[model samples]
Target: MSINPRTIRWGILATGRIAENFATDLALVEGSELVAVGSRRLDAANEFAERFGAARAHGSYEELAADPEVDVIYVATPHSRHLDDVMTCLEGGKHVLCEKPLAMNAADAETMIAEARSRGLFFAEAMWTRTNPNIRRMLQMIRDGVIGTPLQVRAELGYAAEAEKTRMWDPELGASALLDMGIYPLTFAFLLLGEPVSIVAAGVLSDQGIDVNAGATLTYANGAVANIAWNQVAWSDNRGTIAGDAGFVEMTSRFHEPTGFSVTRGDQTETYEEHVIGRGYSHEIIEVADCLREGLTQSALLPQDESLAIMKQLDEILRQLGVTPR
Candidate 1:
């Protein structure tokens, strides 16, 4: 990386709430600037651009992707549009940091990875939770045997949403509890247990054909198991626990957000906290900048293979629930 903070000129490809949050966080991170923003509507693009102090605003994704000044593009569109948006950025010769679940399925993620590899452009899924300091510390502790032999993991993330409205219940938007809330716990489990050898799922689908709530049991070959659950029809504790032979780790609510976790061993418990710069999204932006400056095609912290594996897990979960990807 550069001696000075690595400045990455960024173009945002959506004007949604999450995109706005990411832009706000990007501004807080040193060596990063939001140079452009794009939306299907000119006014929305201009509005977001003005709000974020972006240098330019484009009415179409192509315009933002084609901007020579933008060293990279952030794909913050809905999950359904991720593949299209990411492919456009890659084809335009811009590195991409796509929001997760990378695409609607593993096949799409593989295609995106192939394109990035062939083009020699950096590509990564924005699983910002993996970049969080507390999570990193927890993972290190586990690897160092502070947790001893992993036993079982359990997690849940959910919130209530109207079945008649909102994207959470919309089948056409690729909306589901699994894709939204479930991905966090599922990814968390995957990080701890790796790819599971078998998966069993049971869920109740909403009237709109989306899986409103689901519970999954992932059995790993190493004798580790993860019990995960997600719901859009009700609230859950939204906590995570990683239990091991010697100790356990627990995360408070919003496990995917700026987090506070505790490690317990015998009668002693140690708490770890992470501070966010703006909205907690800036940490991932910093990783992207460092990778770009170092001429790396993927972040060591959140590699392409990890993204692909998570997508596969999601695909299997969806399949078990009879929700096919578009």
Candidate 2:
């Protein structure tokens, strides 16, 4: 927590597809600038920097972290690299917004969060779904009792990825339906209802021991329950529904980055439309900027503890599926 900069200067730590998307969204945010790009190869970094209109390109992540002009970094490395990549930014005296799943497991996520806490740095997982406009509004409505005493949640997010994405089938890389896709539904349930009391999970594991498809029933203390599933072998409807005694809300297809949602009470249904900025990634970027300018260490919108809780759930689900937690 230093003097908050008027215009946050951002750095990208890996020029992957996520990084490209982030950079695109960052441009849409006010009072933010992408000052630098980093990658293992200088050529890749240079290309990304040029394409993104970044002024500096570092061949190594270490070099990018050391750049004094960079107020914060967005780490877009793979899930397996989050622990190390986030630590590098923290060690370099920079704030960070790392990609989702935070880490391979809760333990590693704890280590990263603790380091950020000890260093008094702002850090967060880039769980953009939480920051999407429709999701935020839905959360408010649920809290306002638009849906009274949410009793059950049904959400599924999946797509065919095993054939085209080698990383999705690699255990060493920490690939699993739970980490890559299921986290949305899990987090969705957690947001609407608090943490569950017990979780019963089952899944299909690949020969490599990574989960290819999984489903879980999470029961809460108040008898609330959530049925969520994810898959890498096929396409799901990608919809989510939260039901309560009074009424319910249905998040449209690709619920994670929802197009919109309708709230139903008896025969009356109210629908809300969403015009998300730059594929909905800009919302998180704006949140990060707001937090930085306000001198907050963590976002209330997506707290560090919540991220850890979801990671713990992810670990438990993987373990139940006979895929050893990485």
TM-score of each: 0.96, 0.98
- Candidate 1 per-residue lDDT over residues 61-83, each given as its tens digit: 99998988899899998898888
List the lowest-lDDT window of 10 residues for candidate 2. Answer: 1-10
Q: Which candidate number would show the highest lDDT if scored against the true structure?
A: 2
Return the number of clashes found in candidate 2: 0
List clashing residue pairs in candidate 1.
none
Local accuracy of candidate 2 as per-residue lDDT tens digits, 1-326: 45446788999999989899999999998889999999999999999999999999999999999998899999999999999999999999999999998999899999999999999899999999999999999999998899798999999999998466777877777788889999999999999888899999998988888888989999999999999999989989999999999999999999999979999999999999878997899999999999998888999987999999999998888889998757
The true-versus-predicted C-alpha distance at residue 124 of model 1, in Å, is 0.5
Q: What is the model-wide C-alpha lDDT for candidate 1?
A: 0.88
Q: What lDDT does the true structure give each of the candidates?
A: 0.88, 0.92
- Tell me how far the alpha carbon of residue 153 in candidate 2 is from the true structure, in angstroms, after superposition: 0.3
